[model samples]
Structures are given as C-alpha cells and as structure tokens.
Target chain A: MTRIITVALIILFIITAGCALFVPMQKPVEQDNRLFLWLPGASSVQVLSDWNDWGGSVAAGGIIDPLSGRMEKDDTGLWTIDIAGLPGGVYRYAFYVNGYKWIKDPLNPETALFDGRTVSIIMFTN
Target chain B: MSTSLITLIILIAGGTDSTDVSIIPENWVFGYDCLIDASACGDWINNHPVIDSTSVDAAVSVSAVSPEVNFLVTGAMRNDSTSHVVLRRARGVVKWPGTPWIAAGVYLNDQQPFIAGLSNPVLEWGWVDIDSTKGFGVSSGGVLGFSGDYLIQLTSGDTLSQLNVHSPWMGFAGVDYSRARIHPADSEGVDITVNVLSVRGDFRYFKPWLIVAGAEGEEGKWAVSAELRELRPIDTQWGRIEIVPGMHFAGDNIDLPGSAFVPGQRIITLGAFLESRRYFVSAGIKGMLDLSSDSLSSVSASAGMISEGGITWDVIFGYYADGDYRAYVSSTVSDSYASAGIAVEIIDDSTRVTGSASYSPRDDVCAEVSFSGDIDDSLQPECVLAVTTSLGPVMCLVGIEWEYDSSPSLRMNLTGLFK
Candidate 1:
C-alpha cells in the first residue's frame, strides 16, 4: 500500500511540474465585486456573464485581451473571461468557439462536463 | 406418448381457444379438432399433418381464451412467379370468445397494401412491410392476428401442417417465450426450432418481439430473460451484448465446419451503448469463448451512427483469435471486416421507396432496392417489392419480391368461463 501511494505521489508531482512548464493555469481578476477574465491566444471566445438574462445574449462576440484584468495567457489553450458585477448569487458560464466546439474553464473547478461532451461552469457567491 | 409427444400436446393446447374453424375439405382431421359451443361457426383447429403441397402451404391454430378476451391467429406461405407471397390476417377481437376472430385482423395479400376480411363497419388500413421474403422458407410467410388467446401454425405445400404455441399466458404472467419453428421442405420430417427462450413478460405482438418487452412500461424493463437454442441444420443465428459494468462479449455462427459445437457452442455476450435523438452513437465489444471445446475465442466492437432524418447507417468491426487448446489446424485465425449503408425515404404517404447498399471487406458487397405500398385502409396487409444483388463474383439475387397479409382468424363460438 505504501509503495503504491509513493508511486502515485511521484507520478502526480511529475505531471504537475510538467503542466506548470507546458500548461500554466490562468489567474482571474476581481474589481468592484466583479470578476474579470482574459484569454490572449484564443481565436474566438463567447462569454455568458453574470448580469445578462439567461435567454438573451450578454455579449455576442468578443476577442481575448491579454494585458488587463490581471490576466495572463499561459502555454495551455485556455482564456479567462472577465465577469463583472456578479451579484451575491451563484453564476454559471460557458464558451463557444469556431461555432461548433466547447472547452472548459481551466480555473473554475465547478465546471461540469456536459452529457454530450461539452463543458459548463457554475459559481456560488456570498 | 414420449416426452416429445407430451411437450407437443401441451404446446398445441396452449395456443388455441373455442371458435369457428373450417377446413377446406370436410371429414378431414389431420390434427386435434375440438368443438366448444354453438357460436364457434367453423372452428376446425387443424394440427400436425402430412407435407405434400406442390402449390400452397397453410397452418391453423387456436388458443384458449376467457369470455372477456377473444383472440385467434393464422398464417400462410405461398410462392408464384409474380412474387412469393405471405398473407396475414387479424380478423377481429370481439367482446366475447364465441365471437369470430376474423373481424379484428386485417386481411393481408401480396397484391397491395390493404385490409381484407372485415365488413359492416369498414376500418382504415395501415401497415409497414419489413422483410416478407425472409420469413418461411426464405421466400415468404403468412400471419393472422387476434386480441386474446391464440395458437400459431405453419403449413407448406399440400397436406403438410405444423402447430406451435408461443406465449400461452398473456402479459399477466411475467413469463413468456418465443419459438422459431421450421418444417422441413419435405413432410416426412419432424418440425424443429432454432431457439426457444422464456421471456420476462408477454412480449408477443407478431412483429419486433424485442419491442414488446419494452412497451409493457416499467414492469417489463430491467427484467431478464433466458433462452436455450439449438442452431444447426436451420442455419439461423442469434447474438446479444451486456454493457452495464463495462465489458463486452459477442459471437455468431458463420457456417463453419467440424464438430466444434456438437453439443452447441455457447456464446455469452456483454456490452452497452449510449444514444441520442438526432444522432445515436454506441460502442460495445463481444467475446466468444469456447464452450463446447477450447478451439476458438473472439472479441469484437461495433459502433453505429444515424441522423435524425435523411439517412441512417451502422458499422461493425471485429477480429477473432484461435483458442490455446486447439487440436488441429493453424496457430492463429483472425480477420476484420466492416459494413455500412444508407437509407432514404423517397415517398411519404402509405407508399414509400427505399434503397440501400452495404459491403463487408471480408464478405461480398450487396445493394438492395425496395418499395412498400398499402392499397387498403387496414394496416394488417401490405405489398412489398424488392431486389437485392451482390457487388461481387456474380450478382446474387437479382430477383423481385411481393407479399400480402391475411385477415385474422376470429369466429364466435362457445361462450363460457374457464375459471
């Protein structure tokens, strides 16, 4: 048992360090009780923000901004979308790119894998 | 009587009821004939008979039913140049047993898609033609429908008839069964079945037996059914998959030679699949382990894809491995093949045209064209025309097909309560 655990830990450590070098995690930004996300290298990114109604579009098409929102573009292919004026309630979001595929938010652990292989995020706020 | 004889008797009695039965020739009784009461106008439930029909083949069976439930069934197989035909009829399901079973089932014929054998209050006809030529001697078969208790019989050529009772106890009893019988081309032989297994519920409705189990609602789901079959001289096959816990198994008979399955090789398959509406995707593996002898083992995976409309397709690929305890032949025997096809619905109404092409690299490629039309208002009988030809060595089966459904055998007779 000890040997198995030791081997697992070593494997985990190696993967984490390798990811740090190849796929760095994104950092989100917060201001005025709102969260700002940015993704630099993405060809296209659509955001489902906290303020807009679920049916209508909050923002239709938006390109990634690298410098602001305390955002950094890592080697991995992920973008952070700035979520502003997010209320005290829970917030959910997703990204649609190239008109046909979905990718998970690397920074949000609450994101779930859709039944059909897509990704979505849910947030709980105080 | 021997055990086989007793089994045969019980099977015959299980599918019949009191009704009007008629035999073309009078004073002729090839099988058991029971007259229940006055209403049963021509109730002649014919059973086993000699096989010597050069032109037509028929079988009539009756099942026991209570006063509230009435049912009867009959089927036939015939052949001609214009097309081989299979006629079926669901005569009727009257308020009582002694009532004729004929009024309920739609009379079926090879000429067109229309309901026959019903009058007084005409009904609209509806029917879908599947593979009419594949049933009963690879050319055509016959069937009749009724509401309640019933028996099934098959007769070919002249003077040859065989009776079989499938599900004696309707849906009330959780136990059910299916019997695939074949009467040899010659009447001198005894009738036999390729597979017979108890169903978890009453999944009997003449077509698509699998759908019956699922249609009974939650009660039928999650139920397990066991079956034992002897598939040899019949050239019939069956397969299944268990995919829940994440392992798969599959096996089939490709008409291989030898005593490999003298006692019959057992094929236990386990596999599962995931599907959606517009698009359906499933992946499962099948494993064929040596049951009779450790001569061969096989594992395979099958995947299928279909669109919401337009065309639907399926693909299967697998490989086989030789068993370790082989007594003769080579050290390894494995092969992989794939099949795919598309179907298009050309006409929308009661009549439609469909075409498909399929190929297996290991086997021969084939293409098929078919048309199904219903000329009548009743759904029981339909007309189908089809031609299938091979894309290999020589075009096989460039022939055409046409079939019909017969009216159900329903007649009013003995009015009573068995209980």
Candidate 2:
C-alpha cells in the first residue's frame, strides 16, 4: 500500500509538472492606440477608449484625430472613442453602435485581464 | 586529506550571510528574507512565509489590508544586497487542514525610501476570513498588484469542513415573447403566448468534507474531499405549473371511452433535488398537488443517473390519493389507465450523435434526436428534432407534436466549493 501511494503521488507530480512545463505562456503585448474592442457579434465593430468619443453622424467625419485624442467613427459601421490623452496607465473603453448603445469594441483583438468580458486597452506613452 | 579541504570550503560558503528575494509576475505580493548570519539561519528554506491582504488603499488612508488574496506560491528568498532602512520581522504559524493553506508574508522594501511620488505604494497585509464578498484595493499612487509566491499551509479547522451552498440572485426585468400553436395538434395556426420575465437570485454556501488517513510519519495518508450541493429556485408570481393528462382511445380490446377524457391542470409540483458526484446521480422528491376539479395530493420521487460512458437514465414514479377528476373519470368511464415513464439517453461523442427515448404505458412514447457539443468554449449550439406519438389505448394528443425550449435556461448560483 505504501508503494502504491508513493507511485500514485509521483505520477500526479509528474503529470502536473509536465502540464506546467508544456503549457504555453502568453507573451507581453505591445500596447498601442489601435482601438480595443468588445463586440461579441454583428459584422462591423469599433472602440472608443479613454482617448476619444463619437465624431457625430457622418462617416468620414467620425475618424478621430490621433493627436487630438478624438475617437474614430469609420465607414466600417464601427463606433469608437479616443484614449490617446488618457495618460500612460491602462485605460478601458467600449463601443457606441447606431449612436445609442454603450458596448465593447468587437474588432480589437487584444483584451484586458481585469474582467473576462472584452474591453479595449490603451497604454499611453509620455 | 583533499576531501577534508573540500568539506571546509563548502562549509564556509554555506555560512555566508545573504538576502534572497523573488516575486511572480503581475500580482503584488513579494517574498524576501535576510540572513544576518547564514550559519545561524540554519535551513532558511524550512521556514514558511504567508501573506494576506485585509484592506485596500482608500482616499483618507495611504495603506491598508484586504481579504481577497486567493493565490499561493512556494519559493525561498535570499539576501542579495541591502543597506539603510531597518527590517522589522514578524513570524507565526498559519494552518489549513486537508489542503495546503496559503502562506502569507510581506517584506518592507528597506533600501529604497517610500518617496511621496517615486515610491510605489504596496497594499497593506491583513488576515481576512474567506467569507467576505467585497474586494480591497490600494491607495492612490500605489501599484495595484501583488508579488511573491502564494504558500498554502495546512490546518484542521471548521472553515475547511463545512458545506458551501449558493443560490443565484436573478432578476429578469424584460418581457418574454412566446408563440405557440393556435389549436391542439394543429400546425397551421399560431397562438400568442403570454409574455413573462423572471427576476432570479440565490444564496449558496459550501463546506469541505476532507478525509485524511495514515500514521503520523507515513505520507500514504492523502486528503481527498467530496462536496454536497442543494439548490432551490425561488417561486415567482409569473411562474406557472400545469400538467393536464387526457386520453381518447378507440380499438379492439380497448374499453370504450368518450372522444376525450379531459382532466385539465392536473398537478403542481415544488421541491429540490440532491445531486451526487458531478451530477452522475440525483434523487429528489416533489410535492404533487391535484389542481383538477378533483382534490388530490401525492408525492413523486425522481431519480436521474448519468454514467461516464455517456449513458443517461431517469425514473419518475408517484403515489397519490384519487382526486375528484380521477374519481369522476373512474366512475363515468370504463377503460381508464395510468402509468409512469422511464427515459434513456444514448450518445456518440465522437460523431456528435445524441438521442433520448421515453416510454410510458398510459402516456405517449417520446423520442428526440440531436447533435450537440461545444465547438469552442464561447459558442455551443444544439439542434434537436423531436416527436411524441400517443401509444396505449389513446391515439389523441392535446398539444402539438413538436415543442421546444428555445432558450437554454442557465441557472447560475453561488454555492458549493469548487474541487
């Protein structure tokens, strides 16, 4: 019985260690001004982070200025807010679709670890 | 003579004083130790350091402790280089039986001054009982994270042995839109279903039943535990319970009955179930009250089992006092019948084939075939085609042959400890 228990423990340790060693770790992401997104469905999506807000009704006028920290509203039916001026720390924001709903950006691929729900990240540079 | 010299050199190296420190990524708990004298420190690795957060930084306070630390680390520290600030040391024993308790510790960064602007504030450490739901944070300008390896110490205590139960607090403020067949068994017309949305919530608690067996020195003693779960969904004014059983049978050997034997709204049920071992088997009893024009009361027992091999079965049986409806039907009708049902589930996990069949002597034979499984954690869709044919002496069905619960009702409750 002692031998069996030892073997079992050894097997468990090996399995756990093997799993840990084999498990791929996530790489540190390069933070940028590209809009973070949270849209789960729907064809087109965009983000509005700490940097920018809506650019009004027109499509071309919706593009936010990078320096001015204006949120972009592109022709892709995506809604965006700007986080360019939000400082060096991490800033979270969502999407504004059809001018009424506050939602996360769908198109942005990178996500924040704080909540499992999707949110765009804006790591500002001095 | 050479071995003696080597041993002396090794001893000298081991006796040197040093400071060792390390911290895991992202979290803010840091572990460190100072060996004023290495030889005197003995085996420093033998000492366990545990840390806990009892509060977060608030507007008025610069540092505090919080009760939400949930990770453990197993690592040692050494003194590398140090000067300046005095290091105050505190030590104690923390215990958690059955499983390793999280070892908690905090090291004040002595060399670097806690400068107003440059100093990255650390969350203060505190002991928190695990029952609190509120989380702690740090003061402004302090880093929002933890460092160091979480160490789990083992202790025998009531906190580790109680059943944790949880019920979800659910609230549905929106309206429900339902569409149904206009006429019984008629597919051509559609009926407007009443709109009702439910507000849901639950309270849950969990306790661990840990088993440890062995002599003091033997590691053969292992700790394993099983958790028990009990859940109940609160009733709402909008909830409805309706079970109407009627039959119309015409054939040789089948006693003559009217075109229909209608006992509307036959029963209402309320109770909870006890599921064991990851829902492999569950036994439950529900109070069944007669709602027909007749007065009847009875108790129904239900048992459901699912095997690891993908076989599923369920049995439901009940004993009830004859109600007014049952008495009326018995006195007025000659060929009346009653029966129970058993359902069996079969699945081919690889091919994504799933099906279930139920048979009742007095009721109808119900069967459904579906293909369901997760393509990914984010999206899982199931499509089932079902049909129920009236068997026995009755060839009549009051409802449409096809019905489905479109929304996958997910009851999320806070209860029971996660193994």
Candidate 3:
C-alpha cells in the first residue's frame, strides 16, 4: 500500500510541474483596422468626428450631434466604443460625456488644433 | 655512578634547590631516589612536575590547599568593606551512543537573591539528535519577588513546540503547539495547519485552517481555505470571489504586526478578468462589514483595461462608512510615453493631478520629467537624466536631477562582482 501511494504521488507531482512550467500563454493580437476607445469615471460618452457630417450637426463652428454618436458604458464605470472597417484617412474626434461635457481623449496622444481648441486625432489605414 | 660522584655533579650543575633533580631511566640508583620523591608529590606539585611510568597501569596524583577567604586584588588597592563575596558550584554531563545525546549543567550562587527561600540557582539542559530529526532545550533563572525568565522549545520537521512556562511576575505558564502539512494531487493541492495554545491564567484556544485546491479532473483553477472562524475561497477561470467571515488572526496566514488577530470585521470581495484577441478588462469590488451587526462598513470598486497598440487605464472609487467618497483615475499611452492621473475627495473638495513623460534619446541614456501637485496650484515638475554603462564585471550609473525648488544634483553609483 505504501508503494502504491508513493507511486501515485510521484505521478501527481510530475503532472503538476508540467502544467505549471509548460503551459502556453496567450498573447494579444493587433487589429490594425479597428480602434478601441475607453473612458473611465464617465456617466456617458459619445464620439464626435469629422466623418459622417460630424454625426449630422454643427453648432457654433463645432459638432454637437447627440443623436447618433452615443457610447456604451459597462457596470465598472468604463465607457467603451469600437469603430471598425474605416478607409485610409486622418480623422479628428473628441468625446462628449454626460450629455454636456466635451473633452479630448485622455489615452490618445495625437492631437490637432481646431477652432482655437485642441481636439484628438486618429489616423487609420486599410 | 657512585652516590658521592652524582651528588658532586648535581651541585656543580646549579642544583641548589631541592626541587631540581633528574633521574636516569636505566640507572637503578637514580630510580630508587625518584620513587622516594614521588611519595611527597603533593608538596612539590605546585612548582615541580614529575612523571614515572612504564605502562598504563602506573598512576600519579596531586593535591593543593588554599585559604577559603580570598580577596579580588587589582592594580589599584581599595578597601574591601562593602565588596561582594561569592560562592559558586557548577557541574555538567554529556552522553553519547544513542538516538539522543544529552547534555546538562546547573550552577548555584549562595550570595545571590533567593527563590522560594532557597539560594538563587539557574538550570539549563538540552538534548539534540533525539531521533535523527528532533531536539529540545530549556533555560530558567529567577528571583521569586524581583525578576524571573524562562524559555523552552522543541522542534522536529515542520512541527514546533513552545512552552512559555515562566515570566517575571507571573511565575510559570503557557503551552503552544503548531504543525503544517501539504498534500499535492495531480493538478490540485491541499494545505493544513493546526495551532493549539493554553495559558495558565488565560483562555485555551484551538485553531485549524485548511486549504484545498484543484481536485482531480477539476476545470479552471480554484482554491478554498476554511477555518472554524473564517473562510476564503477563490475561483479564477469563471470569476473570482473571496469572502472572509468573522475576525481574522493577523499573522496566521499573512504577516501582520501587533495583536494576533484583527477583530470585529468581515470582508467580501468579487473580481473577474476577461480577455480577447485585442483587449483585456478586469473589475473588482470589495465590501467590508461589521461582524457584530449587518450594517455595511465600507465599499470600494476598481476596474482596469488594456488594449492593443499600447493603451491602458484604471480607476478606483471608495465609499467609506463615515460619509466620505474618493475617486482616482490613471492612464498610460504609447507604453508610458506619456502618463497621467487624477484623484478627488468629495468630502473635502480636494483634487490632485500628476503626469509624467519619458524619452530615450540614445541606446544607453534616458530622460524623464514628472509633475504632481494640487489641481488648484501651478504644476512644478522634476526632471531627471540617467545614463548606464558597463565594463568587464562592472556596471555604472550616473543621474542628474533638477527640481523646481532645489538645486541640480548629480549622483553616480557603481556595482560589480569579482570572479
């Protein structure tokens, strides 16, 4: 009985060590044509871009369309939106949060000056 | 040689002192005189040495006598009116050729303070190699009304025995024993630990914490530890929840200072991680409660995300039972090419903002600048430049810092190991 228990223990150790050391780790894959955006601690978020007629409105030389440029928020207070299948071009965009506050994307570093204010920019290619 | 001739030779060889005499091994005449001196060996043993033996059976003995009262004389002479006189006796023993080799010693000082009306004494004993794996030792010394102390321990393999039987004012007292074991299955494992303690004037308690994880054929990774007073379980693949109920002993599982356990608090935590080809996100919530009641004590929530193309961010919100709320957000872009963070407290209307940027101008040098302060005040940044270089077996680092309110400082450090 002791020998059988010892043999079983040896086999178990071998399997555990193999799994801990040899298991393959997953790596993130880059999606060149897709843009993932996130904004934390925001009640709501929307993307205002130069494309799609700036979501169909122009107020005081700025885009103010709240109807078609909405972003979704998850339970963790993170607002995220994904834009896919865009043609090759340079686009300017900003975020509208809580139906009133308009701000630049804090995660995106590329920015351009527009109408005496700084706006975020995204360059996409097919 | 003739006796007259030997006597003359001895006088000529400066043998004026009777203690100076030599005996020849083969000369029967000198051997006869040597035996005569051996009979008075005690008188001359202090200044003269003599040994005469041809086999192990031959033996010699010596003795000395001195006055019982002696003074501790030093270079500086002083009166001995109030000086302390001491009388001490000590003995020790050692044994071998068994599983355990025992050694012990005892010392008594008649002039020392008394314990239980007896002369103060100290006892110490120890046994090692008890069974190829065990050993025990103890020491104690004390004055009944003033000071006392003792320590006793026994150790073997993963088990420990501690006997806290003596203390200065409390006399003798407690016993604590604990042991740990681990059993590993194919893809899972179990760990168990038991602690038992009893004190003469205090409560007796027993605590056992058991943890089991990863049973055979189990999916994902899961672990659970339960004690008679508390329980915690974690499951990672689907989601993770850790609930700790009742008061927890501080250093029982993790190291903590002060009391053995923290009382009157319970914690429940929930968290999950989800990852895909392009993005990874995680969220967690921690709730604390008053163990004596059902009232909510405090709550905190945190979430984070990382996406392709070097973007990451995290945020935390805390609501304390004292009606205070705090929120913090931090984000990084381009693998920390630029990073920014903000913190706000609702009760005091205080906010802090911080940012930093890093640039690598050359392969061996990098420059970075960071700024942080209250949001209502102007930002004052600190800039640093660092360079690293290496030579055979030696590495060197040089850095320069410039802060808004301080002079520029240059620092250099070198480290190496020799073969």
For each candidate, give its TM-score against the true structure.
0.26, 0.17, 0.31
**What 10-residue stretch in candidate 1 chain B is worst by lDDT?**
B115-124
When only the first chain is scored, the TM-scores of the models are: 0.42, 0.34, 0.61
lDDT of 1 by residue, A1-126 (tens): 999999999999988755443332222222222322222222333453222322112111111211112222233322334454442222344553211224333222222222233233332221
lDDT of 3 by residue, B1-419 (tens): 23443454454343323454543222111111110001111111334433322111111111111121111110111123532321111112122222222222221210111111000001000111212122233323333422112212222232322222232223222222222221222234332222222222221232222222221222322223223211225444533333323222122133111112222323332222222333354455556554444444667766555544334555667787767777767655432222233333233466766564544333223344445556556545555554543333233445555666655555554433222
User: Which of the numbered candidates is closest to the native, going by highest TM-score?
Assistant: 3
Output DockQ, candidate 1.
Answer: 0.01
- Please compute the TM-score of chain B alone for each predicted structure, in the order given: 0.30, 0.20, 0.36
lDDT of 3 at B9: 42
Tens-digit per-residue lDDT, B276-346, candidate 2: 32223445555645555334466655543333322223344455665221100000000112112222222
Each candidate's DockQ = 0.01, 0.01, 0.02
lDDT for B392 in candidate 2 is 20
Q: What's the residue-level lDDT of A93 in candidate 1?
A: 46
Question: lDDT by residue for model 1 over B1-419, one digit each (tens)?
Answer: 12443354455554343245632223222232211112221212253222232232222223323333334332323333543322233232333234332222222221111111101000011111211211111111122222222222233321211122233333332222222333555768544332222232222221111111111112211212122111112121222222322111112321111111222334343334332212222234445555545454555444432222212233334455552221111011111121222222222233222332222232222222233344346533333222222221112222223334432222221111111
lDDT tens digits by residue: candidate 3, A1-126 = 999999999999988755543332222334433334443333335677655435433311122333345666444334556677553234667775433335665434334443344456564322
For candidate 2 chain A, the 10 contiguous residues with the lowest summed lDDT are A56-65
lDDT of each: 0.28, 0.26, 0.36
- On TM-score, the stronger of 1 and 3 is 3
Residue B87 shift from truth in candidate 3, angstroms: 39
